[model samples]
Target chain A: MSARLACFLPLLASLAVAGERLHCVVIEVPSASLPLLREEMKRAAAPVADHGPVLLSTDGLPRRVTHRGQAPFVPEKPIPLGNGPREGSPAGARSFNIVAASGAGGGLVYDVSIQQSPVPASYYDFRTKGLVAAVPANRWQELAAWNQGTRSVSLWHHLQTDEPRAAAGDELRIELIFASMPDDALAHVPEYPPELTRQVVGHLSGTGRVWKSFSLACRADVPFHLQSSHGDRRRRQEPGYGDRVLAKFQGRITRDTPGHATLDGLLEAPRHHEGDAEAYPVSSEASIGEWRLIVLRDGPTFKAAAAAFHEIYTRRAHVAAKVNVVAIRVSVADEGEP
Target chain B: MRCPFLSRTSRWIGSALALTLAAAPARDRLHFVTISRGYDDLLREEMKRMAGTPVLPRSGKLLTGITGFPRNAGYQGTIRLDRDFPLEWSVQRSGTPGRTAGDFGFTLGVMRAGDGPGLRFDVDALESGTEHDFYRMTAESVPLPLGRNTWHPVAAWGSEYNQGMSLWCYREATAVAASTATGIHLLDVQVGFLPEPVVAAMNTFTPEHTRLARGAMAPWQTLSVSCQVDRPFSISSAAGERAMRGRSDDRGLCRLTGTLTQNYETSFNLKCQWQPPGGKKQPQVRFDVPLQPGRWHLQPVEGGPRLRATGPKGEVRVANVAAFRITAAEP
Candidate 1:
């Protein structure tokens, strides 16, 4: 496809949605701040950890997967966005939160108290905890600013939920805040979001897949020396890994055949693997091999809704290595009728 | 029982078709693939370990004609017989966020072992990671392939730990008749601070302070560098006047052209004007980078300075300065 045409395909797809719309927000977090963000998220998940649904973090990915052969693992540049939710799940009735797909953990999270699917209305009432209550849907754009230092609930990105009201007769409402730009301007939004008023670029549907991606890269050089029979070759070097995953996140919302909306995403993280010490016995090469840990939701975005919390601690150890992690969060928000 | 004349004619026609098919040119898309590393801690330890023991080289057999430390640097060229040479090539650690010893480049080309003719490449391994004057280097077309390339820039006077390099590749397929086998190009001009502790007082407000202190004497770090290119284009105010000329090659690749040169004294004052491809004169963007020895601090302009231009076939951006070394080539 022509580059210009490909750039507008998302905008065109978003404009085509008639009944329900998907709202998403993407935030670029300095990779250095990810650990603190994860810790803060864990604290938020504590209150609802056992009783209710909690957001999924990178703690759920496999610790390691060795490549058996020498062939390079050229991972596909992930499709910006997915398939619908699984059958049996009522469409628009659930939302899933999966963070740091490659096991490097993090997600754009507001509060851990809110359940993944069918968020309890009481969870939005932060006033009970002596914090500011969730802003009414109209002022949601005010919550869009990224605050790396905030300790409490803040809007990570605006997402709408279509899950039915709780049995307690309370409704969940999140509005789609349109970005202030014509369709032609959508392509440049991500690169220059600060120049504009909103980061919520366009809207998708429970069945219509749309995503926003961001890259967070960090690097520092290290010195190493290789001992050879003739002489020792000493040189300071940087890890020669390319732009694979400083970190990659794709937030997606998919609907089941039933039209239920779910908020979920994939996070690709750099898994720091010590190089093969036996082969290069005299070199620090063993410490430089980096693999990717993908925290992915295989079948449906909502399956791990309630199970995401307890698993966070188990996966924490896997992410201890300081590697690249790119988080793309494709979230959902209700448009409030037509 | 066929007639001899008819049979002969059919045979001749068949031979002609075979020859035509064999001679048809293949246009393999071209892009840049760079290999580099940083001087980070893990590498440092690796070096120390190497000094302690005898480590056998881990790379595969090196090609006979190729030169440089390809094997030691972990450059494994075409491993298996690739029937369809995919255009998207992999780049190694080219744009690490920080320090490195240095890096170089070689053009790796391949053909379907016995099916096609041999490949030709012009390799420059000697000047691979050589550094040049910053402004002089930016004025040249550092040919890199389209897609993801690395940008590793260090302070001029910084330790060898912070050096970076830019490189390009050129490949020629003797059997392929199409020029699309040439390459694509993008012009990325970045000017930004070298981060703190490395330098002092070159902050966001430094530009304003320069105007106040010297009245009109703009420091290299605070000067609004102008850039312009020879093409049909649209530019923002922030693009300093640097000339970039691009045109479509036979293979439809937007090949960038032109190099800026000057006497020693004139080199310090960077400026350029352009009459775009269509004979219309757009605003001129000038880049006045200081030539004082040592490190040069660069800062981003307010309101996101960008110079977006449309070449005959592609668009190029001479945008805000970032820490990167771009080596453009056709491979």
Candidate 2:
């Protein structure tokens, strides 16, 4: 199948009644080559009718998923796709199924099952058990380790309970499949670029799935000396400096989903290394060792993006003895399309 | 031998004439004149009543006159004096029912009457006593006039301790032929205390006698003095002193400018000093001028020893002998 037909097949299969309530099962595909995968799926005669994958492609097109015997439901608004899966319960009632498929490029997929329950419950309640059960037996050990680790994942949940019910008091269940993880999927992890530090001040350039083009240039200066008191033995032994950093990001975002975006970066300094010793009273000398620009999103407005920058840098105590995000500038492309 | 005989005879004749003249006694006559200048009939009657005699002229080798001297209201008296000779004079309170204790003074002097006249002799007697103790005595030469019949001021006296008395005496050149009185004459007599020099100075600047406004720095304020003094003196405000020079008109007028700088309600001591034309001593006179806010007028009471400034609200006298007041103008 061609890339366009592959993107449209999920929409054709999921046509359903607008007001009908039903249980849903969701599966996440980890792949940037969603169009190529669609050709393979067609040749293999996979069950695309009952389990059509919702492709979140870089083309910025909307995809739909519907239940049997129901009319097609199209989203009235653009949905943001790259971050994570979205799930919610209705009035203490729980519903859903989830499954994640791992890809060759170390991209993990999540599978979820949802049931139409009378009382509302959170998906976080079954995070460990349900997720562990959904994984293939051979990958169970790897999934368990990832769950136990400190790495963060990006997942989004959105719940809508206003639709009409098929029964007088019966709750509805809806299923959704998220495929084609964006090239920027790794950027969604809360603490990305782990153990990776860039220069104290440098330029950042990356393409976003939602925002087609992205570039960030920044210069940071240590305006004040960060001295730890002698009474604070830990800080005295490991002194740090505070900094005032300035950053500017320019990019173009899809016009339909325009809103505020965020930029996150990391700053790190080394502690004195003693000879074969883990700790010491004081280090010989220290400097800002690294700075990493993890993610930059085109926010709705420049002011909003700058405010987000200020909010992040001001609250961190370890960035320096003191830290200030002095200036921030964000400019949106005037093309108005993507 | 013959010339000696003639000289001895002439000497004997001159010696006999000298002996005859030496036996004669010196002739001195005391004359008195009654002054009617600037007096009313009521005052003359009051003076007559106080003197226990009619205000009449007494003629003798020494003429005596009973004249009315005006002081404050209810203070009028008779002054009895020898017209040409220096003599003693006394003023005993009339044993009247409403008589009040007061001060009085008498001044007798002889002065030359001419373009460049001068006082030859002057005597002054002042007393602040009751009916029994108030009296004055002076023996001075009568004033001589350089011109015939030229009237020259001779005596001046006043009292305001209890009741007011302002009296003056003048000698006409005719009096010089009547009696051999050759001494200083008093020119002006004021019964009450002298009007504060500053107050008098301000009065010359404006009849309203308005006090300078506090912090009034503007058109310079100028005062002209026409008193009898001959030399220039100095006047000062808080801004400091400026010398007052005599006007070119030779009217004995000294003009002073009060350059005001700031608001001052305190007493300003205006000092004036000058040496007599040919005298070695410099007499310095100071007046305490009280400064307040308002319009003022110098009120010289006829009898009292208090110089007062009458404003729209009321009157204020120099309460302290050392200081007078300057009040603010009426709004």
Candidate 3:
């Protein structure tokens, strides 16, 4: 049979079940160590990737440009300072603001943020080549439509400064990106829901010398169906490399896990005619529906992300010392085959 | 300040009249309300113009009530909407900071009617737009009260809220469904509610973020210019944002006034921050000003942004006012 399916009507009529659901989780991190923690995030974040992190800021940069009753102005150039610092956007806006100001003496003469202009061909090329690009100037995403289907967690102070007693003024500042786990603890996962799409469900516990902890019980399914046909007019777009409907992976782990772990992986690409969803049942006529994930250390970046999981682990890499990378680190769970 | 609702004689008369009208209709005597934080007292006086019953501007703040619904009643845990955000929240990723705005404004809360009031859910702390907010919890949810039967229970209310309450995903304070529950499966169980003021307020401050020109009432002069100075040239290691001061001799006057356009809240006051505007460390000064029209402008002082009064040593005698619009205008 198919996995748990969720059907949403365009409007609020012709629906019989109260299948509505929501989920929330809190991230607990030590507070005092947030300063040092920020450095790790900076180092760990994708380096000048295809896109820059939103609401992301660097520590120690002075926001010099400003006018009374105006936004703090920043220069278009990348600013670097000693300590790494930044404030993530509120869970909804999804981005932080970097105000760039110039001409302080004669008043603000140029503000590209308030108006729109054409970008050069060079700008377009940068984006296509996997470099960070800005949204069209002087505009913001619609506060309502930008994120039509996701939930987030509040960035709460998990508590770094809490002390065991007078003898232990030891400060352990950590940053937590508290957010809801993937929606529908058990979704009728689409053969083609979004990807980098993975999920983890399990107990949350503390681990590591720094007390870093996480779980690998979470599970997420990347779109094997390649459902996007917006570019094609032929037969609702061709199916992807997989002729499957859904792939579910179930596993378990604890706080910051380091390397590899065991997982009962299931790959099901059910073969059925068009409208066979309701009556269609998963058959033993299954193909190679299982595989083993041997996760080495963090792959050349997230390459090893597939087997990339551990329980309550920590590391002291040559580049990143005293860094505590947790087990719940999210990676786009993938399926490989020759 | 003399709001019609504040009148001793009007309260009794208005309440009595509202009661009489309430006898016949559901929402009858809910008179008119005009909220203006725009112009000088000119906009403030609109509340006084009410013939009788009137909803005053900010008679009170939002009365908060808390409730959290568990995905499953038998389940050990509960899912409660955040308080800060009327609806749910999400952390999103953007190409650049503040360039792309996200859609966090959606149905923050929902409830369906039963015999009387419906089962409700309140969404409070929404995820601010961040990586977690955007790719994370973006979808919102509300629970329905089954009352055991799980069926035939009429859904009397369902809708969205955020400003104009009708705009920005229905920013209304509350919603009520139509289609009398004559049956037929809660008939017209609908989603309807406008964004109220508080919802509107939530939309105002976004980490993702604007601009100004002169007002229509008083167009920005190509002749006049402005720039701010923090710490007014202090050689100290630290210089704060401080508007340098300016002044004119006996007969001359320095004015800092501006008009506020519609759709924009009128400012409360224009403040100066710098204790000094000269000396060192490039002056570290930043400040916010609450400006209003009709009359504005700080009294002129030496060594300020507006030191030169559009003339030779404070010589210009131009009759002008400082004004701004919700939108940025051309220079």
Give fnat of each prediction, in order: 0.00, 0.00, 0.00
Q: In terms of TM-score, how similar is model 1 to the real structure? A: 0.21
lDDT of 3 by residue, B128-235 (tens): 222222111111122232222111111111111111111011111112332232211111101111112211222222221101001111111111111111101110
Measured with C-alpha atoms, the lDDT of residue B88 in candidate 1 is 25
Q: In candidate 2, which residue ranges exceed 4 Å CA deviation?
A: A1-338, B1-119, B125-151, B159-284, B287-316, B319-331
- Residues A1-338, candidate 3: write the lDDT tens digits: 12322233432233212321111112112322222222322222211223343222221111111111122123443322111222222211211122222222211111111100112110000000011111212211110000001111111111112222121111111111111211221122122122111211111111111212211112212111111001111222334521122212122222122232222222122323453222111111111112111111121111010110121133322121111122223321111011
DockQ of each: 0.01, 0.00, 0.01
lDDT of 1 by residue, A263-309 (tens): 33333333334441112011011011111111222211111111112
| Position B249, candidate 2: lDDT | 17
The alpha-carbon lDDT assigned to residue B277 of candidate 2 equals 15
Residues B192-311 of candidate 2 have per-residue lDDT tens digits of 222243323334333221222101111111111111212222221111011221222112111221212222333222223211111222222332232332223232222222233332
Better of 1 and 2 by lDDT: 2
Clashes of each: 96, 84, 144
By summed lDDT, the worst window of 10 consecutive residues in model 3 chain B runs over: B65-74
Q: What local lDDT score does residue A17 receive in model 1, on the 0 to 100 scale?
A: 42
> Model 2 has how many clashing residue pairs?
84
lDDT of 2 by residue, A31-58 (tens): 2222222222222221123644343221
